[model samples]
Target: MEERHVIVTYRLDHATIHELCAQLEPDLMSAIRHPTGIPPLLQVLSVLHFLASGSFQTTVAIASGMSQPMFSNVLSRVLSALLKHIRSYIVFPQVGDLPAVKGDFDALGHIPNIIGAIDGTHVALVPPSRSEQVYRNRKSYHSMNVQMVCLADQYISHVNAKFPGSVHDAYILRNSSIPYVMGQLQRHRVWLIGGSLYYSPKKVFQIIVACCMLDNLALCRQVPFLQEDGPAGGLVASVEPLDSEEEEVEEEDIDNGNNVIQQYFQ
Candidate 1:
C-alpha cells in the first residue's frame, strides 16, 4: 500500500502500525489457522480504518475482506488485545512524574501544579432493546459516557468508560477510581481528555484504551491528527467550556476553585 493512503486511512504510518501489531500479535494469533481466518495485521488494520474513518461496519468490513458480523467481533478482539498493555502507554503521573507534566501544563496556561485536564464525551451506540433508556444521552441518542485525563502533550493519562450515557460527566468523575488513585488530597488538583468501531460497553472501553494507546504512540511519532494544521500547532486543543448549565461545576465548589485559579495566576 502507498504510504499516503495508509496514513490517511489508518492515521498511523507503516512502521508505527507494525510496532503496534507486533505487540498485539501473540494475543491475536489463532491456535490453529482456518482458511477464512483474518491475520493479526489485517485485523488491526481493519479496525484502525473503521476507527479513523468512523464509517459503517459493512463498508469497512467489505474493504477488509470480511463480513459485517466478522468485523464487529474483530473490532472487539484487536481492541481487547491492547487492554493488557494500556498501563505502559496511558499512565497517570506519580509524584516523581508530576513535575514534568506539571511544567508542560503550567507553561501552556501559566497555572502551576496542574498535572492533567479532564473531559468527557459520549460514544454513540445503536439503542438496545434491554434497558435502552439508560443508554440515551441528553442529546437523545444511545451512547456511553467516556471520561479521559490528558497531559499537555496530548497523551491520554487515564480513561473511564464504565458509565452509561444518561450518567452525568461529574458523576462519572466522582465515581471514578481517579479520586482513590490520586489520593483524596490530590483529587482537587490534576485533571483530563478516540475512536472506534463498536458499541457494547465492554468493547467501548477497550476501544478507548486501544485508541488512546495509538494516539499516544502517534504523538510520540509526531503524527499529526487529521485536523491539526501543522508543526507549529498542537496535538491537543484546549478544552472550551460549554454554555449548558448541566456542564457547570457545583455552585458551592466554584468559589474555592476560582480561588485556586486566582492564586496561581497571581
Candidate 2:
C-alpha cells in the first residue's frame, strides 16, 4: 500500500476501495482457478492507477506487478463489473424530487428553479487506426466530448459521452433523449445553466443560458485538478438572430431566472 494521499489519488480510500473490490469479487472471480491469475484487489488497483495517472497501460501493468496481457484482461473484467453496478452508485433525481433539488441550488446562490448546470469537456484520446478525423475537435485534438449535468452538491445527475470531440455541446443535448426525459417531468420549470455553446432557448423544457464561469457549483465544490488547469476553455457560440416572439420569451426567462442572484450580490 502507498501513502494516504497516494491512495486518495484513486479517488477513494483504501477501506472503500477494498469494499468495492469485495463486492465485485463475487461476480468477477474466475470459476476455475489458474495458479498465475491476478487477485481481484490487484486487478482493481491496476485499473484505478491507470485511470488516475492516465498512464500507458503497459506502465500501469508493470507497476502493478503483472504482464501487459494479464493487465488488459483484468482491466476488462473490472470495468465490466463496474458498468454492471453503475446504477447503484450514480442516480438522477426523479421529477417528484425537483423541489428538494431546487432548494439545494437556491441555497447555494439564491438562484431559483435551477436544478443543475450542464457543460461539455473534451477527454483526449490516442488517435484510432481508422476514421480518426471524426474525433478531431475544433482545437485539433483527438478526444471524446463528454457532456455532464451536475447538481449543487457536485454529484453528476446526467452524463452523455457518446459524441465525438467534433460535436457541439448544444447538438449533443438536442440529439439526446434528455429532452424526452425532461418532458416527462410535467410538474415544474427546472433550469440548467450552461455556456454560450448550449444557449438554445427554444428548448423550453431544457433551458440553456449563458453564465459566468467562476460562479458554477462545480467550482464551488473545489474539484481537484481544476486549480491546475483553471476553468474549461472552449469557443463561445455566436448569438443567433431570433424571431421577435422567441427573442422576447428568451429575454423574459433569462431576466426572471438571473434577477434574484444578481440582487443577492447587491
Candidate 3:
C-alpha cells in the first residue's frame, strides 16, 4: 500500500508498523509455525483494520483470509502480547524528572509547574456478559471511562483505564494514583489539569492498555492519523482526541459538594 493508504487503513506508517510487528513477532511465531495458521503480520494488520475502521469481524477476517472465529482468537493473542509490554510506553514523569516536564509545559503556555493535562474519554466497548449497566455512560452506550494525561507536546504520559463510564469523574480521580503522587508533593508545584472518569473485566482492561500503548508508540514515532502529511521530518501531533462534543459528559463534583480542586490543593 502507498503511504497515504497505509496511514488511513492502519493508522500507522510502515516503519512504525514494522517495529510493532518486530515486537510482537516472537510471541506470534508459535501459532504461525503451524501449517494451517495465519502469519503474525496478517493477524496484526487484521486487528488494526478492525480498530481503525470499526468494521465487523467478518469484513476484516475475510479480507485477511480467515474465518471470524479464527480472527477473534488472533485478536485476543495480539492484544495480550501488546499488554504485556504496556508499561514501557505509558510512563508517568518521575518525581526527579518533574522539573524538565514542567519546563516544557511552561514553554508551551507559560503555565509554570504544569507538568501535564488530564482528561477523561469514553471508548466504546463491547457489552460485557455481566454487570452491563455500569458500562453504559449517559450517552447510552457501553464504554470504558479512560483517564489520560498528556505532556506539553501532547504525548500521553499516564493512563488510568480501570473505571467504567457510569462512575463519577471525581471518584476516579480520588481513587487514581495521581492523588497519592500529589500527596507526596508536599509543596511541589507540579499540576495535571483536565476533566473526567469502570469496573471492567480483565480482557477489557488489556484491550484498553494495549490501545494506549499503541497511541504512545505512534506519537513517539511521529505518526498522525490525520489525512494531511506533516512537515517533512517534523514532529507530528498526538493521536486525535477520542472524546467528541457529543460524547462530552458534565463532570460531577462527587466529594460531598465541596470543590474537589480546592481539596486537592489544600
Candidate 4:
C-alpha cells in the first residue's frame, strides 16, 4: 500500500520573518538542538496573545489551534529568549543614575531632577486556591497588580509586575523601588509626578517640567486652537471652552420646579 502526502504554503514578508527569527534562541547550537523549529506562527501568536489578550498559555493554545504541550514549549522558548535579551535591555530605566537620565532627556528640552511618571493597571488572574481570601480585591475580582512608571515623554521607566491582587497603590509604591528613588532626591532638583497625594506634589511638578524641557515638546498636546486675527494682524489662536452654564441652570430648574409629590418620589 502507498501512503498519501500533503503540502501547505502561506505568504510572509522577509522583515517579519527576520523579527520572528530574532525571538528564537541566539546561539546556533541551541537553535540546532531543537528538533522542531520554532513554529513561526506560534511565536507570532504568543506575542499577539500577550499584547492583545494578556491570556495564559493554556488559553492562548486553545485559541491559536495548537496542542497544549506544543503551545507551552513554544511560548516558553519565545518568552525566555525575549525576556533574557530584549526585556533586560529594554524594560527598565536607570533608577539612581543621573547620567542616564541626562542622556535620555537632553535633546528634548532643559530641566533637572526628573525621572518618570508612575501609574498602576490591574491584570486579571486566577485566584490562588489556597490563598483565595487574599486574592479577592475590593471589587471582588481576582487580579494581579501591575505598576508602571512612565516619563513625561511617555517612556516607561519601571514596571513592577510581582505584586498581589489586593495590594494598595500606595502600599506598592511604598514597598517598591519608587520610594527609594524619591528618597534619594535630597541634593538634586529632580522630582516625580504621581497621583499619590501623600508624596511631594511640588516635586512631581518639577519632574514634569524637567521632562517637558528634556523632550522639547509639551507632555500632552492641546486641543487645536481656533485661529483668529490678533491686534497686530498676526494669527492668534485659542481653544473653545465647553458651555456648562446651560446644563447647570436646567438642573437647578428641575430641582426647584419639583412639587412635594415629586420630591417624595425622588
Top-lDDT candidate index: 1
Q: Show model 3 residue runs off by greater than 4 Å.
A: 31-33, 196-204, 228-266
Off by over 4 Å in 4: 1-20, 27-34, 37-46, 53-65, 90-114, 196-266
> Which tens-of-lDDT digit does each residue in 1-266 have in candidate 4?
00110000001222332444555536322632344333443454344343233334445555455444555445434444544443433243444675566555554446555566568865544454677766566778655566777664565566665666688988888888777766676456566656511112222222222222222211222112222234322211222121112111122222232331132223
lDDT of 3 by residue, 1-266 (tens): 56777777677887888789889888887655344355567667777766665555556666665655666677777887787787788888888888889999888988888878999888666556777899889899777887878998877877888888788788888999888877787478777877501213555577667767877888888887654455433212222222121211112211211232232123
Clashing pairs in 3: 118-193, 163-198, 164-198
Q: Kindly report which residue pairs in candidate 2 clash with one another.
A: none
Whole-model lDDT for model 2 versus the true structure? 0.56
Once fitted onto the true fold, the runs of candidate 1 whose alpha carbons sit more than 4 angstroms away are 31-36, 184-198, 226-266
* Cand. 1 TM to true fold: 0.75
Clashes of each: 8, 0, 3, 8
The candidate 3 region of ten consecutive residues with least summed lDDT is 245-254
For every model shown, what is its TM-score relative to the native structure?
A: 0.75, 0.67, 0.75, 0.51
Cα RMSD to native, each candidate? 16.4, 18.4, 15.4, 22.7
Q: Alpha carbon lDDT of residue 214, candidate 3?
A: 79
Candidate order by decreasing TM-score: 1, 3, 2, 4
